[model samples]
Target: MRSETTPARPLGLTFRLDEVPAEGRRFEGALTEQSLGADLPGMVGDLGYRPTGPARIAGNVYRSAKTELVVDGRVTVGVGFDCVRCLADRVLAVDIREDHVLVRRKARVVEEGEESQTIDDEALEEPDVETFSGEEIDLTDLFRQDLLLALPMNPSCDDVGADDCRDLVGERAPDEPQIDPRWAPLLEMKKKMT
Candidate 1:
């Protein structure tokens, strides 16, 4: 639910040019659930997960080019969701590794009648490329995006020692022929044939 068109606001996880050394830098931070803001609650509700605690992010940002940075990081968070089978709340610890290329946006001039520009094939193929046009790069959205994608689509507590799950013994009922009223005539015909 985060928007890229809106102006960037510092979430205290921003990395400015001055913070990055010529050789790059390693940064770490802990973002509490409250700091993640309202968008996160909506996202978590949609995913049927209840956040249990803060999320920790740690990573290294490398200066790939004068106006480009490569970020490699890990986000870890604890969440609680109902088991798909038993409907019992189950706690899950998720850790997601993120790698992204941040490119400084540059202004471009287009002439009249020129064809509209499109993303390059390379950029389309690589999903981690993002563009920023500012002195500071805010990683708040990136962390949220990664965490959402990393959530299990169908979380189930089926592991050993999970007592909340229902137990059903396999059994077979007696084989009995069940004929619908509409099919009774056909069954009679088949019996006559036999």
Candidate 2:
């Protein structure tokens, strides 16, 4: 007699539903920068944040329903970017918590007399929901999106007193008179009135 078994998955952020146990499956792995492939580069380019090193992901996938899987995880990554103020290269370590629901796509069969229904606007706004047709659940995209969103919008070198930053400050010497040319006439009138 042959027993049914779940297919084995290589180490990474992908899991097959059949492999997940009734109690849930826990996974831990590190994804190198090279392993992330081309999509990562494009996403980094668009977001202006570059990955400085590999990312570590640890998570649990639970069978919430017969056709749904719930994924909860934490991601730790190092990101690099040019400082918005100083223009110096800055690196930041980011940690993000991810939670999502993956649902199996149901085949739609419309009868000749049956009318098709469209999804409502409220359904469109649900951020944690995703649909998959195959038995495999790939969490790579979800993890990447979470990491990108967790990055700071304006990264800074945090060295405002440095020489490079001082050059950009545009401060004049204490003895120098700082005045706008347009206000010269007003200054002259005030001096005459005094």
Candidate 3:
């Protein structure tokens, strides 16, 4: 399972920085989970989200002023995850359009007596802006960012109607309240006061 915080290396969704024409070009393809791995679903099983099908990607890349790459695209896929109510597997169909403003990464310059690294934000107000370095621009990265955003923080059968949610209707916890040993004194004090 892949950790949510660490990003896997590029899985071959790259385009040359100098190759994009001013007129812009369209790129489209279907990305299989095998290619994107845990990022798409099965690989991120630890995150409780998985892809049930291939992710379709279609987009346009254009080289703009300041040598920035702008991406406009759409992705459609099904995500499989355990429902919060019953632990039953459920699938959520996802289709979303995303636009990314990508800028080439500036080389970090460490000066004398510098205790921290401060970034220059050229497009600080632009939503969904990203940065890359070198001659290659990886679209796979864009796919990863967008898909991660699409996942619901809490998925339940009731949310998507994936199931009837009847499984938890009559379930009940043990009559005894669960308590932590460290909190016994505090809890006892409160009970005495009551």
Candidate 4:
């Protein structure tokens, strides 16, 4: 699905060094059904009016002279996984709190000899909060990450029964009996006596 770019979000955060607050603020938004679409990692198909809970996101942005914006937040999402027994649909909830650091590469005026360690511009452009651009950041990728990690490794919902998958792992067949040729005459004599 088409997603909104970093610049397309509401003008909420500028992430300037001077304008940044000493205490970080809280950011909130909804990860609507349309937002997830078919791109969701798990088999999160729309099963007739299934509404996922409103995901909550809270984080703090710390700004430094060397770095532009540093953000940390907790993200929680509700997931639905099918039950292993009885083929029932089970609801699983997962929470992921990720920390992010954003560096203002555009504003960097460091000398060639200055040896500073920080996340580069390309890294910051990624979706998750690991890093973000100083110009503008989008949280859509961060939301997607949490949901993907919460899904189950196996998709089957039914329990495996013993009868369905039982065989002594290393069983061998019994050897066949061998009859003596002399026994054929003895067997005929025994039958005549009877």
Q: Write the per-residue lDDT of candidate 1 for residues 11-116, one digit (tens) a residue.
A: 2468786567556577677667776443333332244567788889888787888878888888998877766555567777888888989877665555789875
lDDT for model 4 comes to 0.47
Which run of 10 residues does model 3 get worst, by summed lDDT?
172-181
User: Which model, 2 or 3, shows the larger lDDT?
Assistant: 3
Q: Residue by residue across 99-149, what tens digits does model 3's lDDT show? A: 888877676787899864533365444445787878888788678656655
Question: How do all models score by TM-score?
Answer: 0.67, 0.66, 0.63, 0.50
lDDT of 2 by residue, 1-194 (tens): 65985743433577678877667778776667765443233332233456777788988888888888888889997766655554566667777788888777665676788876433233336646777767887888777666655554344555222345422675322322344354355445444544
Q: Where does candidate 4 have its weakest 10-residue lDDT segment?
A: 158-167
Better of 3 and 4 by TM-score: 3
lDDT of each model, Cα atoms only?
Answer: 0.64, 0.63, 0.65, 0.47
- lDDT, candidate 4, 1-194, per-residue tens: 65963332222323345445555454556566665543342232223112266555655656654545666666666655443322245455557776766554454566888965445656555634355545466656655554544443332232221233222343322222122343345334433544
Model 1 deviation from the true structure expressed as Cα RMSD, one decimal place: 16.0
Q: Rank the candidates by lDDT, best first.
A: 3, 1, 2, 4
Clashes of 2: 0
Order by TM-score, highest first = 1, 2, 3, 4
Task: State in Å the error of residue 25, model 4.
Answer: 1.7
Worst 10-residue lDDT window for candidate 2 reads 38-47
